[model samples]
Structure formats: C-alpha cells, structure tokens
Target: MADVHKVVFYPVGNGDTTQIVLSGGRRVLFDFCHRERAEDTDTPEIDLKSRFKDELKAVDRDYFDVVAFTHADLDHIQGSTDFFELQHAKKYQGEGRIKIRELWVPAAMLLEEADKDHQQEEFVLLRQEARHRLLEGKDILVFSKPKALADWLEPRLNERGEAASARDHLFIDAGTIVPGFSLASDGVEFFCHSPFIKHCDEGDIIRNRASLVFNVRFLADGAYYDYLEVGDATWEEMEDIVRTTRYHKNDDRLAWDLYNIPHHCSYLVLNEEGQKGDKETEPKPLVKELLLQGKRDAYIVSCSKPIPDIKESYEQVQPPHIQARNTYERYLKEVGGRKFLVTMEEPNANKPEPIVFEIASGGVTWKRSASIGAPAIITSTPPRAG
Candidate 1:
C-alpha cells in the first residue's frame, strides 16, 4: 500500500469546486465558483481576500501546483479574477501571497475567437498571466487543443479585445488526454473526455456542452483512484464523447472512484427531458449503464436546491432550472453501488464547507468541516416535497 491522497470538494455558491492534495503534498484546485447567489440571499459568505490568503496558509509555502478551470461559466471563472488580484497585490500587510506554480486550463478556454462579452474579462487576465509566466519559462500545460485553439483565439483577443469574440470561443474535441502527474510520483493525470470541437446544439441551452470533461487519476495504497468531474455537460455532450472516443461500454478505463454528476444531477443531462418535462418513462438505461461502467464509489451533486419536479410549474420549482429530483433518486437506486452526496443536504447556515476524502491503504474515508445536519429529500413535485 502507498501513502494517502486527499481530495476536497468545496461547497461554493450554487456550483462545484474541489481541491486535490496529492500524496506528495501538492495542491490542485479543480474549479472556483462565484462568491454570491443570484437572489442575493444569505448563504455562507466566501471572503475572497481572506479565503485566498487562508488557502495559501492551509498548504505549505507557495505550494499550490495547479489551478484548473473546467470551463468559462461565470460561477467558475469569477474566482480567478479575485485570485489574480490577490496574487498581484503581493504585499498582504507586509507578507507575501502564495506563488502559483502553474495554471492548467483547457486549450479551448484560451481561444481568441470567443466574443469578449460572452467570456469573462477575468478569464482573459488569467490567461494573459499564464502566458506571461510561460514566456518567463514557467510550466503551463494547456490540455486538449492548447496549441490549435491558442493559435486561433489569441490573435482574435489581441485584435478585438476580450469582449469582441465573447461568443466565438474555441472548442476542444473529446478524448484528448493532458499528461501531467503520474501515480509513480503521486501526481495527478487528466483523461480529457468532452466538448469535441465546440458547436453543439440543444436549443436555448448555455454552452455548457463546451465544458472540458476529464477523469483525474492517481494511484494510492497500490490501488488506482479515479475522480471524474464532468462539468455541466448535457446528454448530447455525453453521448458525443462516448461515440467519438468509441468508449467501450463497461470499460474499466472509464471507471471512477467518485463522480460529480453532470449539471447537478439534472435529468436534462441524462435524458431527452428538459424543463418542459421528463420524457423518460423508466430510468434512462444509459444512466444505469454509465454508473455500471464507471463503478462509481460515490456521486456528488452541487446544486442550490432539490431537483425540480417535472409536474410542477417552472416557477414553483425551487430552481426551476432543471428537471425533477425523483428522476435522480429513482435512477440512483437502480444503478446501486456508491453513496450519494448532495450539497443542499448540509445543515450549515453557510453553504456546506468542502467535503474531503482521503485515499490510503485502507480505502477512502471522508469528513466534513461544515455542519451539514442531515440528508433530506425535497422532490420537485408536491407529493414528494411535503
């Protein structure tokens, strides 16, 4: 058995972000979310300045190895802006801020073709800083289409400013692997999976399909540990990856120890169903198939509210954004293997703090810093919620 590795999934705003601490003691951040919610309700407040400083303090000196932005959604990219500001203002009351060793983003994210307004300016700044660091000979790995997309997006940004090509961003194809840490060194490796070449159409939906999905793997205790974070990608995107990669059904290569369910376990990402209603009569077979294939040890959904009911009015649904909760509960039971973790179940006044899992010779064990009281099920439909 090898030493242990720790992964922390932080409960940020209404989204998902996790921190990966390797056995070698290197720290990596998967995604960072917005500081506030849309309705301006009181959730746990994330003090960016203090939190950033605290994150550095928690780890060893200047030891944050990598910061990965899964995609360009506001919730994910907003923190980078705050991070850049904090990093730039080196002197914090005469102390030094943590030095970022490297920044890894998808190649498509750095594209010049995107309309400036469509993409956040902070992302542009972060990309620029990374480029500057690279010019100074710092290691920057642009996984999946870094070269090709950088070639396309950089010039466009330079010519039109960040907002000009906001909507015209570059997209990376699925199944591209970005080589990084090896299990031998207790490092992390990403197996790229989605957003094959950008343009996917499902009507009025945000370009979440453009998200770069990846399976992060590392070895611990002589056993392989796999964590799959498939950003808010939809059914179309998932199908695309499976088909394009020729990912064999039930292949162990696709198996995972943990999975962050796409779009917070919304049925839209699993079935043809959208906000209109669930089209699935029985469980979506693919949902079960993926679970079986992945051999998921656990599932995590980062959502603000319970899954919306298909029968209710769009307004009545807590989030009204995605489909009913019953769909997931039903599907989970059918798939049956791992435990399910949802952020909304936390009892804390603030959003539940991150959930940390340690992987060691004995297997994985998790603990929570925040007081998430108990798990409760709030269905989207009336009969279930009450």
Candidate 2:
C-alpha cells in the first residue's frame, strides 16, 4: 500500500499523547503525557518517549512538524519540555530531542495576565515556548484570539506600528482553518472549532473551556476520515459546537471513522451530572443525537483506566467514567460497531499496546506489529505502538 499514515494513541493513564504520522513522515502530536518507566501493572513497561523516537526513525523524520496543545492541562502538557526539542531550532543542532517546528495553542495559554493559581510547571513552560516562538515569527498559530485578547493586542500593535497582516499569519480566529499543512499530500487537514471568545473573556480561567477542539480529518483517495478530539470540554461547549457546526452546514466535518473519546470518556461531555451517588447520570437528548452521527465500523477509544461501573465522589471523579463508556457503547451499537478499545487494557496480554488506527483506501482499521502486541480486531500493520 502507499506509505502508511496512522494515528497512534499512547496508553497514558487518564491523560493523552496522540501521535498523528501523516504520509511523508510529517508528524503532528495532539498532546503529550509520558510515563517515566512503569507505573502500574495495567500498562505496558515500554518507555513512551523511546517508542516515539523509534517510530520517528521508521518514518525517516527527525522533527515533529507540528505539536498541537488542546489546552494547558497538566495531563495534556506534562513531560513535553523534556520530550521534545523546543528551542534547539533556528540555530545549532546536534540531535538532542524531537524539535517542534510549529506549535498550535489557544489564546488563554498566551494570556499575559492569566490566573496563575492553577498553572502547572509543564504548562507554564509550554506557554512560554509558544510566546517565544510567536515573538520570533516562527510558525506559531495562536488558535483563537478572543475579542478581549485581540483588543488587548491592538494597542501593542499600534505602538509598534505592526501592520494587521504583520501577525495575522500567526494569530488565528476560531472556526477558521489552520495552515502549515495540507490534506492531499500530508493526508490530513485540521479545522479549528474552539476557544470561543466567551470562554476566554471570563473572569477566572476556565482551562477546559479554552481547549482547541478540531474536526481533525485524514484524507485517502479523495475520501475523508474525521476524528473529533476535545480536551476536557463540557457538555455545554459540546452542544454549542454541534449546533453551530450543523447550523453553518459544516456537517461534513463532524463525520468520523474512529473517535478518541473526549475527556477520557467523562460524563461531563454528556451532562453536568456525570454521576449521581454511585448511579450513572443520563445524557441529554442533543448529546445522544450528536453521537448517533457515527459512521459504520466506527470505534470509540478511551485512553484511561478501566471504566468502572461503580461511581466515586464528585470531588475525586476521575475520567473514563463507566457511564460515559456505556453511552459510547450504545452509540456504537447504533452504527453496527463492535469495538471500543481501552488504552490500559490489552487485547490479550499483561500490558496495553498503543492503539493504532490506520487510514487506507478501503477504511480505517487497527493493527499491531509483532513487537508491541496484537490487535483484537482487524490486523494489517495499522501502526505499531510499543
């Protein structure tokens, strides 16, 4: 087949680290949360950073073309500075770490006066890197510039006498397309959908509300494969996205072959009351209707611990909630789907393998090389993950 293009979802516990290897070895990482060695018995003992390096070699690429941070959550941005080569660009190079040629971040991450009460060290570093890259005129696309932030920058631009287009190439608005990649050749196209002005203009930083949700599409033989990944988005935001996209006749962007279940399968994406005293909460009608749009053979993969049927207190409710998984399961049933992969669970082994979703002419399928593990569903070298 043509050179393989795939998306590998690492088995990080309740966190995300998805690597999208487009055709021609162009790499785009969604988020990063690496395991140092081995934390628990449920996950494999493979070093995630090392595994990524080996995969990069297979594609014969030395740097990540893009690294998109959905939001500044510790779970999403953790271990990023140590893993990727950030500042080793535009200067001396000796092969130290994976260089990030381009960065995609929401405006909240770059807000100069952001509320630091909840900032994580990794997130702080990531934000600083984005800021530095923008100042250097690098390929840094600020995902969504709310009117507040945009207004906040107008004076600075006037003072510096910088033309509107002087930085328009780097600053982006929501619902607009992101550049620096193509679909026909790169095998992928990204459409921005989040960091709404309302989300950013709030008094307190609602971190999750500022996430950069995208209708990430992969093209193959003129056909498009869609995957929706929203980091920690609540049901309110999810509903608005569905209604807005459909209202604007952007339904084509919502179709998906494989869905990376958002918020680690949390019910917050379904409704505010994810659980009610050990009993799962019911999803709203619109949320249910939206999920019914899944394509045939669609799969929902949750990258978290086992979605337990029991409930926990709201104060300590970890994501990948069993109730939410049940919701996705029912939706899959509607679409004649039979697979719902959990990252921490093995196909039939002591550890979990990187769930690989390969995009080919026929359709999407999951395959595992002999090194990492085996696929419980279809097999065909979907994409090997250690």
Candidate 3:
C-alpha cells in the first residue's frame, strides 16, 4: 500500500459526522451525529455507535487521536455523550466507551450559557467534559481565546492557584496551523479558518457563528491537498472569513480540494439572509470567489439528506434545500470539478453508505461501494502540482 489516507462522511441526514484517517493509523473525527432511531436497522441513518465501534475493533483501538466538536448544536453533538468516555464524570466512563486522546472544541463550548430548560442537554454535558479537560491542562485543544472564555477561565485558574495564562499554549487561533501535527511527520496540518475571537467576543454567542472551521491540508509525495471542514456557518461569517483571510494575505487557506459545504447545503451560507428570491440562490461575491478556489477535479460534499428536485422541495424551509444544491452543482460545473455528493443520496436514499475518499501520492480517489442493487463505480482524479 502507498500510505493512503481516508476521509469518511456518514449519512446522518442533515447532520455532520466526518472521520479523517491519516496516512498513519491516527484518526481525527469531526462532529458526531448518532440518531437513536438508527438502531432499528430500518432507518436510513447509519448506526454510528455500532459502525464506529466495529471500525475501531478492526484496528484493535479504543480511542481517537483527536475528536473535534465543531459546535454544541444537537445535530453535531447528538448522542455523543453516550458514545465517548467523559473524563469529567465516572458515570460516563468504562463499558467500552471510545476514548478521545485529545478533545478539540471552540471557545464557545466553554463560555456558552445554556437555557434553564435545556441545562441538562448533551451540549451542556459536553461543555462540562471540555471544561474539565481544559482545567486539567492535558488532552485538549481549545480554539480561540476570546475575552468571554478568558473571563470564565481566568477565575477558575485563579481558584486553582495557577496563572491565568498558564493554559495559553493549548489555545489555537484562526489563521494558524494547529500544533502537534505537521505535514512533514503526520502527512496533515489543520489550518484554523473561522471562529475568530470577535465571533465569540461580540454581545451574544451564536453557536453557528462560533463554530470551528478548518482547512485540512494533506501532504502526499510532496503534494498538498486541502479539505475545508466548515461547520454550520452562515453567509455573514463566510464573508468575514473571506475578508479577514484575504486581508491578512492568507489566501491559500481558502483553496480546497474537498469542501464539506456548510449548514447542510443551506442557502443562508451562500446568500444573505432573506435573499432567496431567485430560484437558484446565487453565491455571494466573496462566497463565489471561495467556490472558485476549488482546485481541478475537486469535490463538494454535502453532509445532508437527499436533495430531491421535486416541486415541494423548492419551497422547503429547512436545509438540504434544492436551490442551494443547484448553486453548488453550477459552480462545480463551472470549475470543472468532479462531483457534488450528498450523504443520504450517494448509492440510494434507502441504504446510503459512507462516502469515502482515499488520498494517495497520486491524488484523491472516491471509493464507491457496489451493493447488490447499486452500481459498481470508482472514480479517481489526476494528480495536481504541489
């Protein structure tokens, strides 16, 4: 084998769950959406708990190198508390629960205040776990140290008889490559692109605005391929990222070979709020530029339900919107890109499998499954210059 890497996107139906297996055995999972109904075996959603456990068992492992929770949204963190062993509480430990060697979360996860009625939600529990690890000063990475987080953390550190800035190294900011992983050694480097300080520091905390976004660059035979794993960011945040990234001369971070489109292909990510007048939502000026940054034979993956071209679908309010999908397909065609894949519609909506992309020295290749009724298909894009 030629040191191939794998990126797997699950069919979570408008939710987000992506796993990146490095050329080495190390794995990093972004978001986790495990529906309870999936256990029935009849639901379209995969049984994430069973699949993840089986996958880890095949390798004789019990933990992930990095488990990043982009935001505390239900779709992103649903059923996560029951799946991963929480170091903060003994009740959540043991029983074959998967361990996270290093947990990654945005500052919002630490500072957000839960509503009284939703205080016991999974997001709150995950926040407690993240806070515990951060306080312990080990096995955790907190993205962006906004003032709100600092205010909360400084008092806690003071109570523990430690310097307020003691845990600064663990905090990663936007536009910088995450430490501990380098292309030279790990064949991958994550460049933080969003969840800037302002996003969290401003008056009220919006989960989507404070979500984590990264440009994951994979190195293979001296060539670099980018994967943009954006959370449920809206058009305002997208524009901010474009303006700030370009202003700082970090334009290359905008380029992507594999783009996980934001908000389950929601038009709000491409157009301004209340601007869906056109049947096909046109991408905002900066967003269009970002789409154009897709490299040759690039792919845009939508981690959402099937986007049908039916009459009722056009007027659908929620995500997996047909209009947004149309815009993405248009841009993919304009750029001569490879495919626009939907998680729940890959092979078929009834029993969709994970969309796997293998990265090798040659280039990226889509690994298609040949189920009984599904077509046997395998597509590989040509290698690009480093």
Candidate 4:
C-alpha cells in the first residue's frame, strides 16, 4: 500500500464503469452501468451499489471526488441516480451511499433530442440534478458549451454581470486543459478531448461520438504516464481526434501508457466492415498509429463481454468482437512489452474480479481483489425508491 494510485475496471458485463483512485485519495469515476441481471449465463450478477460503496470505503470517505458521465447511454449512466446521492437531503446523505462532489458532463447531455436516447427515469433525474447544480453554481462542470448553458442560466447570470467569472471554472472546451484540477496531490492533468460543438448541435442524435474522451497525464516516479479514456468512440471520431491532436503538434497528447479500447472492442472502431477472428482486415491507418504508437509498457483494457474466437461467434458479431481482440493481442505480442487485459477474464471463482491497475514511478502492476464473487449486498440501506 505504498500510496497506491490505481484504476479499477468493474466487470459489469458489456458496459463501461471505471474508477480511478488517485494518489491523494481523490476518486474519479468514468461511467456506471450495472446489470439487474447478467444477460449471459457466464457473466456474473453483482450488486453495483455495494460494489461502488466498497470503493468509497477504500478512501475512508463517503463520496467520489468526481463522477464523469461520458455520455447518457443507458449502459453508462443507468443506475447513477439511484446509487449516488442525487439530492442534498438528510435522507440521501447518511445511507452509506456516496455523494458526488462534482458531476462532469458533455454538453450533449443537455440536448432535448438525447432525452429519447435515455428514456429511463434515472437519466431524467440525473439531468435534473445537473441542472440544479448548474443553476446554483455548485457541483457541476459543463464541458464544451457556453451559449446553451448561458441560455439555461439566463435572467440570473445575464443580470448578475458575474457570468464571465463562472466561465473560468464551470466551462471547459475540447483541447483545453482542465482548470485547477488534479488527482489527489499528484501532478495529474486531465485534458478534455471530445464532445466537440459539432457533435452536440441541435439535431445530432448520435450519442457515441459525444463521449467525453480525456487524455490523462500524470507523473509517477520520474516519468510521465498517459491514460486515454475514450468512451464508445466510432472510427469516424477516432480519425478526427488523432488527426486534430497531431495537427496541433500535440503528439504527446496521443501517446498512451494505457488505453481503454473504444466501444468495447467493436470492429467498427477499427474499421468500417467488421473483421472476423484472425482476419487481416487492415485497420484504419490512424487507428493503427493510435494504439500501436504508445509506450512500450502500454496496456489495452477491454471493458466488455469475454471475447470468443471469431469462427465460434461470427453469427452474432457485435462488440467484444473476436477479430478486434485478436488485432489487439497481435499488437501486444509484437510489441513484446505490452499487455491486453479483459475484465471478465480476471481469475476468480463464481464471479469475475475487477481488473485493477496500480501505477508507480517504475510502471504499473495488476492488483487483484482480495476475495472472489461480488461483495454481499448491503442490507442496512432501504431499497432505492425510484
């Protein structure tokens, strides 16, 4: 426990949920989607609420430092309103449930068209909470928007003459460094890289491209480690991101020590037509450069269902695509110093262990859970009331 700075990927089936515990006990959550029940028999059924609380317990705290909703997809923000404190009420504060100190969201989440994309009441409530925070200028950080947010803040902010002041802390645009932020006391800098204004225009309904991708750079021992979290980005967006970062002379921004594969290893992220197992469908040149052109100790984490051999699972070739996994595996082996880890494949019994990576000056190492199967569901807190 040498001041462990770690990132944990929860095994919530073919969805995304990652927790980063920084050096100083500051916790940042990427997304959250827990299954009421696992769709596949092999997948484990776990209590998401309890699992999240355990992470809170690790820091001897009762809340997350920041909870980032990469996008409003059901698999990403589905159970948030229920799991975290959504209101500033006594009842919501003392249930052993954690509070979110800040909510990081892409501007796309505020769009009315995206509401249909997340018809769940949980999402509606989350939006309400975010709106509440934005109005109060409290626990909300709006990325990539001002006019739209200003419209929401009209009458008050427009009259106060303080709107210009809020822009320093409340608003962040793509390619911009986060204002006065870090992971604990670590020299970690998070750079916002997605939800470009074009993607959130009034009529844009494609939510995947609105993902809040960030390039996280931090100093460990003496070197810098870069972690890229791109939630469900399509190849089209990936192409733009790589090209834009390169053109800006931000090549270091694209270099990664760890990369969470986009869209859960979907073949579409690699190319247009799906590449089957062992098939040599050449990946888009830009994508090859993005993944292959990384630190020698680079890692690729697949947050999805266990990958099956291409021939065995070709009939329903969706995400966790065997061909995609094969492509990554090939790269790792060829590099001879890289790793490709999958959540479900972590060793354990009765359930999959969360895949945790501990970072230090030397490099990073996998930290396995202490016990197998999901922690027992908490009985003290009453069931969430909608």
Candidate 5:
C-alpha cells in the first residue's frame, strides 16, 4: 500500500487557497482570499459567507501547521488578520483555538524595508508584531530579500543622487527557501525557484517579478511526491529565474508532478504584448516548451471566474491584456498528458465539491466531495516513465 499525502483546494474564487496534508499529518496552507466578500458578484459562483465559513469548519481550523501568504495583495492576505483574530477570539470565547505552529511570508510582505506605502496601518502593525513580538519566540520565516539586487541598484541611485525611493526595499534576494513541513519526514524539502536577485525591479513589477516561487518534494510511504506553487508570478519573473539562476541546471528544481498555473493561467506572463483579446491564437510555443520541460502531470488553475472563452470579449480592453481562456486552452492542448483542473466551472455544482487529491498506496487520486453530496473519485494514472 502506498502511504498517503492529501491536498484540499478550498473554493476561494479567483484567488489561491490550498491545504497540503503531508503523509505524517502535518498541514500547510497557502494563500487565502475572503469568500465572504463576494457580493459584488463579478463572477457567478461567489458565496463569500458560505465558502469562507465552510472552509474554516471543513478543516476544523485545527489542521493548519503552517500558514503562508504569498504577498501583500488583499486577495492573498484578506484572511490573515481574520484568521489570527478568529483563533484568538475563539480562545477567549471558550471555543477551541486553531494552533498555527508557524507563519511563513515573504519578508517584503512583512518587513518595513519592503513597505512602499508609508501610511499603511495594517502593514505597520504586522511588521511590529513580526519584528518585535513574533521574533521574540514565535516561529516566523521570512523568505529571502534581494540583497544583491539592492546592492546593485544602490550604487546607481547614489551616482544619480536623487532621493532614494522606498521601492529599493522590495527586492527579494535569491536562494532563500521557506521552511516547510512534510508528512513523510520531519518537514518537506522545499525551495524557492523564482524572484532571484536579478529579477527584482521596482513597484508592481517588482512585486510580480519578486513573487516567491517554490517546489515541495517528499516521499510518502513508497511513493514520491512533488508539487510546484508559484504565486501570481508573471513570465518575466519566470524567464529571469531560468536564465540567471541555477534553477534549470538542477533537475530537481525544475521538475514537478503537479503545477499551479501562474497568474491564473493568464497569458500576461508569456508575452510583452499583454493579454490578447478573446481571439484564440496558436498557443505560444515558449509556454509549451516550458511545460514540456517540466513534464508535469496535473496543472491546476485557481481562478474565480470561468476563464474568458477564446471567442468572448477581452476582460480588459487595456493594453497588455491577454485573454486568459485562449491561453489556457492552448496550453492544455500542447501539454497533452497533463489534466487541467479548474476550480470555477460550477459555483454550486455538487458533482465535484471541494477538489481533493490524495496520495496513497504508491499512487495519487482526485476526488470531489461536497457537503451535500456523495464523493466522486477519480484515480490518477501515473505518467509513463521516460
């Protein structure tokens, strides 16, 4: 029998929220978007209150060992304050508290050095807690900062003698691996794959470029487990990692069993000419090449809405807007073996409830289990050995 590793991708609509349960039972959660605030009704499936509350109850809030926030984007961090406060409040209210063993976040997201908005009160409070209170004894791992890039840019600024901007603090240094827990061992072997020192620029570009990309690898029972999670990162960020770093040189770093499509499968990451409108073009050959190189078996897209159809109007008429649906369809066709899983097809469909992936007995299987229905199981066939 194969040992088991379990992952639950909670429905968060257009934002990323996934829970990884290791073989040894340790649980790690990545990113959280508030499901309660879906009233604007931009997408059809948003039941903010139900989804958010149900997710918390489904996990019993007791399963989280590590909670990670990819960046400071509201969609990513909306639940942090709430989660923390809820746990604390529950403790005070005589309800059992969810114990978060540790908190992992990008240093740029938590530290003063990375703050571009001087007036952000939440940022200030988080920094204060992280630096003074949390660092005192609590477990907090800050991903690497871009010291080399910062140093490189520092000299240019001095030479110009213009006011040094707060943007300099946003650079993420390369090679810093966030601490991770595993089911098979004491912890999972994980490493950052992007936002290397060379990629850090300024502003949103820096945020998107400096986004932390990492891979988790472990052995559960006799089966090998591997997955990649790249937070809302773009192609420019990816190209830099491939060209400037040692990432591609190491097979372990680039390979994956499952991959989270970056930027929700948006084509903005692939071309300088942003999202192409609703028209479908042949898939970008470069994207195909990258996917082929990784040889992933499962590709997950965590988007809130149905990816815009190739024939639909472009979501954004602005320059640089790439049609997400066209990109997704083309990529799926190019990567023939891998199954593409999207979370937004049925906001209220019962056939596929919370998407569940499990590794057990030397293999993995996907199942859909909803609160109101029976579980639909799909056993995964291992990829043919090369």
Candidate 6:
C-alpha cells in the first residue's frame, strides 16, 4: 500500500486550526482556535474539543506530537488553555485534557508584556506555560533567539544555577530546518521562514509581525511536496522573508504546493499600506513573487468567513476582503493552480466542513468534505516529481 498523509483545515470562521497527520500516524497541530459556542452542535464551526478528543481516542492517544501556536492572537489561541493540559499550573491540568508532547512558540511569545487588563487572558497564560517548558529544557521548541529574550532568560537560568546558554538548543531560527523530524526518516521536514531575530530586536514586538511561518516539506515514495503554513504576517514581513530567504540562497523554501493564506485574507497581507482601491488590491512586488512561486496545481486556502461579493462586503474594513480574494484568485490562476478555497464557504456557507488533502505517490489530491452527506470524492490531479 502507498504511504498516505493527510492535511486538514478545520472551519473555525475567521480563525485558523490545521492538523498534519503523517503517514506514520504521528500528528502535528497548528494554531488551534475552538470557539466556545461551537460546542452547541448547531453552529457551523466544528466542535474542536469533542472532535479532537474523539480522534485521539480512536488512535488510543491523548497527546499531539507537536502543537505549534503561531502567535498569541486571540483568534488562534481561543479556548486552547482549556483544551490542553498545561504543565505550568495545576488548575489547568487534569480534567481529561489532551497533552502536548512538544510545544512550539516564537520568542516574542516569551518576551511580550501584557497590561493589567490583559494579564489574565489566555495568551498570557499560554505564555507562562511556554516559559515553564523552556525553563525545564525539554518538550519545547522556541523559535528565534533575540537579544531581548536572551537577556530575560539569562537571569532566570542564573537563578536556577544553570548556564545562560543552557537552553540554546531549544531555540530555532529562520532559514533553518527544525530539529526533530527529517524527510529521510519521518517523511517530513519543517523549514523556519519567519520570526527572525531582527523581528524581535526591532523595538516593541508586534504579534502579527513576529508570528511563526514555516515551509513544511513532505516526502512520499521519492516525491517531495511543500506546504506553507503562514501566520498572520503582513506584506512588509512577507517581503522581508522573501528578500532574506533569497539572500541566503534558500529560495526553494518559498515555493509551495499548498498555502495557508495569512490574516484571514486581510488586504494588509497583499499591500502593506492597506487597500489600493475598491476593485482589487495588487500584491506588493515581493509578495507577488512569493505568490507566483506556487507550483502547478497549487492551492490557496483562507481560513475566514464567507466572502460575499456584495457591496457591503466590498467596502468592509475588516478581513475576508473581497478585493484580497480577487487578488489571490488572479495569481492562483497565473500559476495554473487547482483551487482557491475559503473555509467557511466550501460546500455552501451554511454548513461548512473541514477541507482535507491527501498526499501520496500520486502527489496531492483534495478529498471530499468531512461533513456528513458530502460525497466521498477526491480530485484526480496527476503526480509531479519533486
């Protein structure tokens, strides 16, 4: 039998939650967003807690191999504190909570400060948990080692009678492959693309600018594929990634077979200075180059609400912008891409389902919706060699 790997994007309505199920049955989850109301059963969004638990039970597991929080944004970390068993606090542990064998966080998540009003929020709590894991020097990968983070962490290490550089191996930087999984052994490898040290060194830490981005490369039967998991980075940051990556002569990291579009299809991701006009927003030069790197039969997925073409939606200030959607669709066509999918609008907006893709020797194919009543269908796109 052929090796089959699965990638799933859950419908969380203007949020992000994706899972990568490797052929070996190990699972890696990215940026969970479980709306509290989704548990009602009548809501359009999936009941993330119940669904994830059920999936784990079927496999006789209660932990994810790795759970990466791209950033501390509310949309990405919503209800995450309640879903996972946090090691930092006894109050958050137990209660049948799922465990995270490894936690991945950007350095900014460790250095950012919250005001008194926001101190008790989930982001703050998650930050505490990340700090605890890093201090323990195991079961965590903190991306980027900036001066600010080092300055803050060194003192704590000294207080604990450990060397200042004790946790250096725990830090991952841009333009490098993550340590754990390798394509040769695990059929997958992750290349860090954003959250550079400079991103943290330059004044205050902007969550979106400092969020995590990775080029996830998957191998199957001598064929290699790339999936880009981008956080809510803006056009300036994307341009920086493109420029820096090219300067390092690691341009292959920019190419992608599947792209998780950033910031819920916000126009800022296309043009740094905001929308160009009413009709469509042209991507900045480097952003355009990044989009054009999509391979044949590529896919761009937006984890946002349904983007209607009506006048009200066109003039809206917030995301799920029609103009940005138009820009993405135009460039997707230029690359001979397969589809531009919106999580909330797939198979009708009223009852959206998780969008899934299966990767094997046949390359990548979009499978049917995971929702009940949807056809058990799969696209017949031919495989392409890496």
List clash counts for every candidate, in order.
Answer: 25, 2, 0, 1, 19, 0
Question: What's the residue-level lDDT of 32 in candidate 2?
Answer: 86
What tens digits encode model 2's per-residue C-alpha lDDT throughout 1-386?
A: 46456778887777887878776667788888876645444446445677777766765667788888888887888777777766624332345677778888888887745467745476776766777676666768887767666675666667777754566678776676677667866878788878787787777668788888888888776667788777778888888887878888887767667777677878888888724234444667767766887787777888777654543533346666666777778788887664788877745435667777777676677766433223335664232110
lDDT of 3 by residue, 17-97 (tens): 999999888999999999999998889999999999988887889999999999989999999999999999899999999
Task: Estimate the TM-score of every prediction.
Answer: 0.72, 0.86, 0.96, 0.86, 0.73, 0.96
For TM-score, the strongest prediction is 6
Tens digit per residue, CA lDDT, model 5, 1-386: 44566666655555777777666656677776665545455534445345544555675554367777676666666545544533222332223334456666665554335446664454454444444322233456556654543454345556656444433332234554443443335436666666554433343335555556777765655556567778777666666655544444655565555667666556666655643544643334444455554443544445444453443345554322236545554565555535656666533433223567765553445666664124545645644332
Q: Could you arrange the candidates by lDDT from highest to lowest?
A: 6, 3, 4, 2, 1, 5
List the global CA lDDT of all models: 0.55, 0.72, 0.89, 0.72, 0.54, 0.90
What overall lDDT, based on C-alpha atoms, would model 6 receive against the true structure? 0.90
Tens-digit per-residue lDDT, 191-267, candidate 6 = 99989998889998999999999999999888899999999999999999999999999999999989999999999
**Model 3, stretches more than 4 Å misplaced?**
369-377, 380-386
* Candidate 2 regions with alpha-carbon error over 4 angstroms: 1-3, 37-46, 88-95, 112-120, 151-161, 274-280, 308-316, 370-386
Report lDDT (Cα) of residue 126, candidate 6: 91
User: In candidate 1, how many Å is residue 132 off?
Assistant: 4.6
- Best-performing candidate as measured by lDDT: 6
List residue ranges in candidate 6 displaced over 4 A.
369-376, 379-386
Q: Give candidate 3's TM-score.
A: 0.96
lDDT of 1 by residue, 253-275 (tens): 46666667766555566666533
List the candidate 5 regions with Cα displacement exceeding 4 Å.
38-63, 85-97, 112-124, 147-173, 176-187, 198-205, 244-248, 275-288, 294-296, 308-310, 313-322, 346-352, 371-376, 379-386
Q: lDDT per residue, candidate 4, 1-386, as tens digits? A: 34446777888777898888777667789998878665455647445677766655764778888999988888888777667887644444555567888899877676544346665576666776776677678878887773555566666666666664564477788888886575445657898877777786655457788778999877665556788888888888888888888888888888777788888888888888644435543578898887766667567899887776656655555677777777887776665435677777665435877776767755655557632222422212221110
Candidate 6: residue pairs that collide: none
